[model samples]
Each structure stands twice: as C-alpha cells, then as structure tokens.
Target chain A: MVKNKIKTVACLLLTLFFLGGCKKTFNQPQSNPEAVFNELWGFMDKHYPMFAIKEIDWDKTYAQYKNRVKPGMVDAELFSLLNQLLFTLKDGHVTLMSATDTATYLGFYKNYPLNFNLANIKNNYLFNDFKKAGPVMYKIVSNVAYIYYASFAQNISDAELDIFFNDIKATKGLIIDVRNNTGGNPANAEKFFSRLINQKTLVKYEVIKNGPGRNDFFEPKPFYISPNGQTYAKPIILLTNRLCFSTCNDFALYISLLPNAQIMGNPTGGGAGLPYNYILANGWKLQYSATYTLSPKMRNIENGIQPNRTINFEPQDENNGKDIILETAFNTLSLE
Target chain B: MIKYYSNKTVFLKIGLSLVCWLAVVNNACAQTLNPDLYKWTFTLGLGLNSNSVIDKNFSQLPYSGNGLGLSGSITYQGRLIQQQLNLTYGMATLQNKYYNSLYATYFTANYSPLFCLNNASNSAFKILAGPQIAMQYARRNYSGFVNNNSSFEFSTSLATSIEISYSIIPIGLVLKNKIAVPVFSYMQQPAFGFATFFANSGSQNSVKNSSDFLVPNKFYRIINNFTIDKQLAPRHKILLSYNLDFYKINTIREVKSIHNNLIVAYSYLL
Candidate 1:
C-alpha cells in the first residue's frame, strides 16, 4: 500500500512538471491592448506612404477600436479585428496570423486552381511584335481552332468571350486547352463550358470534410448547367497536361463524362477541393481545404484526372513551337 | 534552545531543496523515448550568397539583374505509419543595387516511406513527396540618368512545388538533402490594366515588354548539412553546424540557363 501511494505521487508530480513546461513554451507576454492599438494606429498614420485616401479620420478610427479591445479577449477576436483593418487598406499583399491559423492558410494554396496555358490577344496588343509563345496557343491549318486558357481570371468580357466562342464554333472542331490551369472562380469556367455542354449534366461532386471552424461533414455540391445556354454542338477535344488543376481539371473530368467530349494530352494537375479562409491574430490569414472532391465514377480526383487518350509533349517540340498535343487533338476531331 | 530551533529550520530548508531536485530527475526518467512516435523540431538558419546575377540572355531579353540574399527556415517532423513526414516554412529576401528586390515565402509538407537499406545499422532512406505553397514578390524602381523609365512592377504569384528529400542521417546530427520542382505557377500580371496608363502617355507598352516578372521557368535547391548537438548543462546545448546550398533558376524555354547561386552558412543552432 505504501509503494502504491508512492507511485501515484510520482505520476502526479511528473504530470504537473510536463504541464508546466508546456505552459511556459506557449505562454507569451500578455499584450497590452491599448499599446497594440496605439502602435497600429500610429504606424498607419505616420508611415502610410500613399496619401491616396484623404476623407477618413485615421485618429478617430484608431480611438474607436482601441477602447473596444479587452485584456481577456481571445486570439480569434484580435485576428478578426486585424483583418478588418487590413481590408481597409485594400492591399492584397497584407495579411495577419496566429500560429493555430497557419495550417488552414497553407492548405489554401493546395487546392486553389487548375493549370492551363493562356493566350490573350489583348495581352499581345499591349506589346508590339508580340508572338504567341507557351503551350496555350496553337494554329493547326487554320481549320482547327486551339485555345489555351491558363486561368479563368483573364479579362475577357462575357460579350468578347461569346464572340470568340462563335468564331471558334465555325471550325471543323475545337481544342479547348487547359494544360496548366491552376483554377479560379468556378463561375468563370461555367461560362466557357456552358457553351459546349448541351444538356444539364452533373460534372463533379464536392464535400467539405474538415477545416477551421467547419462542421464535421458537408453534403456534396454539384456543377450544373449554366443559364447562358449551349453554343457548340460539334465534337470538342480538351488538351490537358500535368499542370492542369482545380476547376480546370473538374471541367475536363465532368465534360469527359459527356459522349461528345474527349480528353487528350497529359494527366491533370491534382487539386480537387475548395479552400476556406480564416482570419487569425496578428493580422495573418489562414486558409485550408474545407472539402474533397470525387468524379462521377466515385473516384478521388486529387491524384489527377487521367485522359481518355494519353499524349505526351516533347520538350523540344515545345521550344520549336511544334504543338504535337494539339495535332493529336486535331486529328482525333477530324477522324470523328 | 535557540540554537536547536535554528538547526531545525535549516534542516527543513535542505529537505525542500532535495524534494525539488528529486522531482526534476524523476520527471526526466519518466519521459520515455518512443522511436515509433512523432517528434517536433524547430530550426533557424541564415544563408549567404555566392553568385547573384539574373541572366536575361536566355530569354533574349534585357538583364533582370540579381542581388544578395538572406534566408531562414523552421520545420516540424513526424512519422505516420511507414512514412516520414516533414512540414517546413521558409522565407528569403534579396535586394539588387538597382532598386530591384525579390521576396519569396513558402510552406511545404512532405512525406516519404522509409526504405530500410540495412536492418543492422537501422539507417533508412525515403523519397519525400508533397505540396509546397510559394509566393514571390518582386519590385523594381529605375531612377538616375542612366535609365529612361522609372517605374515599379509588383507581381503576386501562387505556385505549387513538388519536393523530394532524403534523410542521410536519422539520430543525432540529422541531415536532409531536398530538391523542389515547381509544377504549376500562376501569377497575376502586375502590368495588367496598366495598358491604359501607357496608352495615355503613348509610351508603347515598354513596361509590359520587360521580362522582369516572367515565370521562373525553373527553380530548385539542394541542401547538404550536418547538425551536431550535445547538452552542455541541463536543457542547454552547444550547437555548431555547416551547410552548403545550391540554387539554379532556369530559362522559360529550357533552351539556355542562367542565374545560379550557391551559399554556405555557419550558424549556432539553439
């Protein structure tokens, strides 16, 4: 009985020591809320290099927020306030953080976009003697059209895109290239795909599994037909490379399921989810994947979407502007 | 009677000191080392550049220029089943004399399965695989009578990198050699919508034609180092180390290569 008592005492003491050490490691000096607010306000007032905005009273804004902060306020509350202040600057470069929020922030880059090559005439218009380089543009006999969209973020207006689509619709067949697209807003992709897809069809399903401040399970969201209506009834070929990612990959995977579409080129860049952002203390923002996606065949698309017919691009061909991948797509369309 | 009381008080003080010492010793002994379990590690490092020149001849464009740089990193490591995993965060900033600056920040999570070479020595190797989030910021200002244009271009790039690291040492002075390959790099053109600015001035888009913000057609690094550590007294250790790093930035067409920097760093690891 005496020995047992000694063992229990030893265990209790060890636990206490471990807990104390952990507390010391994580404990930071309590920040004086008033001092922090004053410092932030002063930095903005004195060092704001740009005198762009003259209307708002910086001092009043600082005074209002300074008094609202309390000593016991959690890190989340501080982070949210910092984010609000940063957003006021309208600079996309600035961000804030706490240690706990970094994981989500790191995760945002993982599933952000699909990879594709982009070709914008306007981009060329800005430069004289501009030659179309990169894998996104191809000219095959001028009869078959090739277009590489590196991202959906291009400034192509809806009307301008419609006209471009109409121009391509006259070709024998169209090669929609999304070789290195990393992804952007799904709405942008929907605008392009809506013109090709005839009937309402399910493209991809998404489920948010885990993330900061997220629920345990979320139902899958589906990609549906766009209201803009269909444009192309002819056979369409999609050229993809390992760089194809995110929404671009999803569009290819979903459209491949259609009987009228065929996917060629390399396997896609693997990003099959959505990332949600959370503001943290220290004005750092965290983003993480709040979801996972599966193709219609119930296969996880994170490893990448495999092409129906695989065609590899030689590095030498890419340098010489000899687009072997586009040639394959053109031949496939012509054969059809 | 007074002397006896003082002695008693002294004895009590000695007893309390003994108790505290025993508690510390007991806790250390109870902390078992589980080889199968995960361990967290933090690292800090400083780097010096060997070569700093942005070779623009590969693209047939004007020189982008280069500058000296400093870098640092912190990492956490663990084992999940047969796989060894590491999560690292790193940053570097470089400044050229011509008022051009480059900043890079990245976070990478990697996993590699332990391939036991010889069971007798317990030394194993693995190929790391995972994703890296990288952001590069570049800004340049051209002033003085030497240059005609004076402007600043800022590019925000989001890229994913695939990395592979080999653990040459496992126990005391663990060394890992890693190489990262950027697969997808998407950058917002800093010159986007600036065409109107140039159009108004009839400058003919000179800024957009400059290859200052071209995609780093290729970027990779190699790190070789040994970490030696021994406890000097209690929780303190005299950490001494040497590290060699190599960085190569390739051209967009993979036709010609330029911009190579090698660094050797000596640091006291805490």
Candidate 2:
C-alpha cells in the first residue's frame, strides 16, 4: 500500500510539473489613456525602423507626449496626441485607425503642387481616342506610344503584356505615365520591370527590422529584376510627380536603372518602407513601415527618388488644357 | 584541439540513447508478457476547442477564439505493445480587443507505438511509455495588414510519450492520463516580414528561410490528455476527455500558442 501511495504521489507531481512548466502569462495593458499612450510609444520604440533616418528622438518624443496623456482623456484627445506623435516621423505610410477617425500624414505629397491633370491628357493629347488593354490605357501619336497606368493595384498578366507590347511594337519610343499613382502591390512593379529589362539586373537592396534596437537590422539583401515576358527595348520615359508613392516610388527607382529609360517630372512621393499593422490596448490600430528598401548603391529612398530631369508643371499650362510634363516627355522621347 | 558540439550533435546522441534503451527494455520485458491477447479499436471524437496565439511576426497581442474540433484515432493493442494513429482538425475565428478577427485553421496527426510496462502488476495500475512522431500544420488569415495578412506554420516533432491508467472493477470505469513532450522539432515559420522584397525565386522563399531544426530549448511543446471511459457493451465504450496543448518558439521573435479541448468519443471494438 505504501509503494502504491508513493506511485500515485509521483504521478500527481509529474502532472503538476508538466501542467505548469510551459505556461506563459500574457500582459495586455489596461484600457486607459496613459496605458494606451505607453503601449503605442513602447511598441513603436521596439518595432519602428526609421528613427535614425527620420532624425526623431523617440525617447524625447515620449517625454514630450507622456505628460499630455491624462487619466480621463477622451479617445479623440488621445488620438490627436498620438497623431501628433506620428506626424514627426514624416512618413507617408503611417496611419492611426480608430473606429471614428483615421489619422493620416500626407506631407509627402499633400503640401506639394498637384502636377498631374488627367482631363488635359485625355482631351488635348489622346482626344478621347485611347484604347484600353487590360489594366492600361494607351495611345500612339507621331510614332510615340503613350501608356497611362494610374495604379499598380490592378494586375497586368503576361497575356495582357503580350497584347500591350504587340500594340506598341511599331512605335519608336514609349511614354509610361504614372503620375498621382500613390501605391499598390510591388509584384505589379516587378512584372512591369521584367518586361523592360533585357538581362537580369541587380536593381536595389532590401533590409528588414530584425531587433528592437534603433539600428538593429539584417544585412541588406540584393533585389534583382529578371527578364520576363515580352521585352521592350525602345527609349522609355517614366513620368512622375510628388503623388507617386509606395510602389510608384519603386517604379521610379526601377526605371532609373535602365540605360534606355529616364524619369521626368517632379520627385516621387517617398514611402519606401513596407507597412505593418499593430493593435493597442484600446482596440485602435496603428500601421507603420516595418521594412525599408535601399538603392543599388545602398542609399535611402525614403525621401523620394529624384527624377533624372526635374520639370515643374506650369499652372498656366493647365488653364490651356496643356500638360507641360507630358509635352516634355514627348520632346524627350523624340530626342532619344 | 577543442571540439565544438552543436545542438544537432546533442540531439543525435540523445535520440540514439533513447532508441537503444527502448530496444533493451523491450527485449527484457518480452519473456514476462503474454503474446496471445490482441484487440483493435476505432474511435471518433467531437470536441469544443479554444486557442490563443501571439505570432510576433504579425502582432504581439494575443488573439483568441473558440471552435469545434473533430478527431479520429485507430488503436491496435497487443499483449506487450499498443500502437495508435490519431488525426485532428480545427477551425476558429480569433479576435483581439480591437475586434479585428483572424480566421485560423490547423490540422495535426501523430503516430505512437508504446511498450506496455507493469502489465503483470495486480495493483490496478498500468503504464505505457514510448516515442511519438507528430506533425502539425496551422495557418492564419488576417486582412488587417497588407503583405503580412496570411501566415502559416508547418512543424514536425519527435516526442516522448507516457500514459498511465487506473481501472476500477466495481464501477467498470477506467481513468487514463497521457502526456507527450517534444524533444526535437523541425519548424517552418515565416521570415521577419511575411514576405521579403523581391525574394529570389519568388515569395515562397519566406517559408524556406525560416525553416530550422530546433531542440526543446528553442521550441517547446507539450500535449496532455486525460480521459474517463465506461464500457456500454462488450463491443462499445464511451469516453470523456480533456486535452491541453502548449507550444512556444523562441527565435528572433517569439510565437506562443495554447489550446484546450473538451472531447466526447465513441469507441467501436474491431
């Protein structure tokens, strides 16, 4: 009986040990203004990657914002404080989403001149005679093929690429306009670049945030653009403006790499980092850039990729239904 | 000369030792065991399950949900050995405090062949111990983030399993408890970001980059099962069970998950 009792006790002890050994406690913060502020600041302090690049002292920012969060602060008040905190980052990809309001920072493009006019291009240039091919609108004028791709959100399949290239095969040069294209899937950018490169080209580098430290990052990896689908070898001009962001910024960087291509118009809106979402204790969501893309020379493209030739769109030209940027692209393509 | 031993070397040595020990024990206990008795049983189970996960690659907050689970197992019991194969699948809609929901699904399968110990004892206690091989595939779909919306984990583990049963003759009931702890595992999770920019050979490289052979120090898992069974007829039995599973992976980032299940099963003697 004593031996049996010993065995039972042993079993009970083993069970308890196993049950308690691997358990972990989750510390979700309390739903209060101060807690929410601390949580947001703490999360960003760990996960945000561009503190040094943006030249913001986060600890100092925390000090400035911490005392503002009161015990009885309303949600809107708290949201405004957080918005002010995020605004200092000067990132186009950052947004604070709540049930009632979505706070965004549009300084990358909103403060700049709106350089693109779609009505002028349709009426004055294409004369409303552009042909639609899948996700792109194209027109041929004076042996120059003009393709207007408004956004990368829509995919251009290989078959569609075949049709697009076949229709523009007879042209001497091409003008690919992506003005006001904020962003979309980067895969579409890759697909579009593949057709432009004749050989595999090491286009840029990419790095991810690996640690919580301000400077902790993985070694930069090479991003290559390989030749795929229909190849286009004619002189190519990529039009851009401050409204070109995210994948459009990537498009600008890619077009600059080709010997046969040049980027015209203003600098692209810089949103070079990949954005990710996080939730706070109060159920509000915060989205911020988690990974950053680097140029082939390992330079930061966060402030926007500058054009090969800067050409400002004259406001007077808009009154006459004339797009000077488009006119410049035509002149540049003709010179090529 | 200084020799450096890696985790892989330690795992191989320990695994070999366990295999040799099992062989010796099996041979030693063979003479005392009856070889004529054999039985086969098939079991189908329905359960209510709940799980919580914190995948740091996506978010640090715990997302939890409840769902129904289905499990099936086939057991072959002999005089000296018992082998079983079990499969389970579950689906859940996990939510956070912010009401953002993520749909999750997981499937698990394991096979274990245990050698019976204390079979000749008259103390109303029976014990079985052996090694188990288990595989789990789990995926989560969250639309809250672009490029990081979906993530999946595929892992295979080699675990040590132990089972103890106490039979009550007067009440015609059996109480059994089983525990399995993984000693070594091969886990495949997503990379730092769900997908890297222009990853060579496309997007699947994220899954390939995060695959690693890990020991218990890096990845820990435990499965605990308890059941009370009563025989309805000579060829039928009903069981009520509670199972708990927990696992944590400690890499650059941490991912922890816990599951609790309450199950009802019917066994058909075959």
Best candidate according to DockQ: 2
Per-residue alpha-carbon lDDT of candidate 2 for residues B188-252, written as tens digits (9 for 90 to 100): 87665444222223422422246889899898988887778898887888998777778888876
Candidate 2 residues A224-253, lDDT tens each? Answer: 778986689999999999989988898899
Retained true contacts (fraction), each candidate: 0.00, 0.22
Q: Could you say which candidate leads in lDDT?
A: 2
* Per-residue lDDT of B134 in model 1: 42
Task: List ranges where model 2 is wrong by over 4 Å.
Answer: A1-28, B1-36, B76-83, B111-120, B129-135, B154-160, B183-186, B195-208, B211-220, B232-236, B268-270
Q: State the lDDT of candidate 1 residue by residue for B98-117, as single tens digits.
A: 23333433333333322211
- lDDT over C-alpha atoms for residue A26 of model 1: 16
Instruction: List, in order, the clash count of every candidate structure.
Output: 25, 0
Alpha-carbon error at A309 in model 2, in Å?
Answer: 1.5
Q: Give, for candidate 2 chain B, the lowest lDDT window spanning 10 residues.
A: B198-207
- Candidate 1 chain A minimal-lDDT segment of 10 residues: A21-30
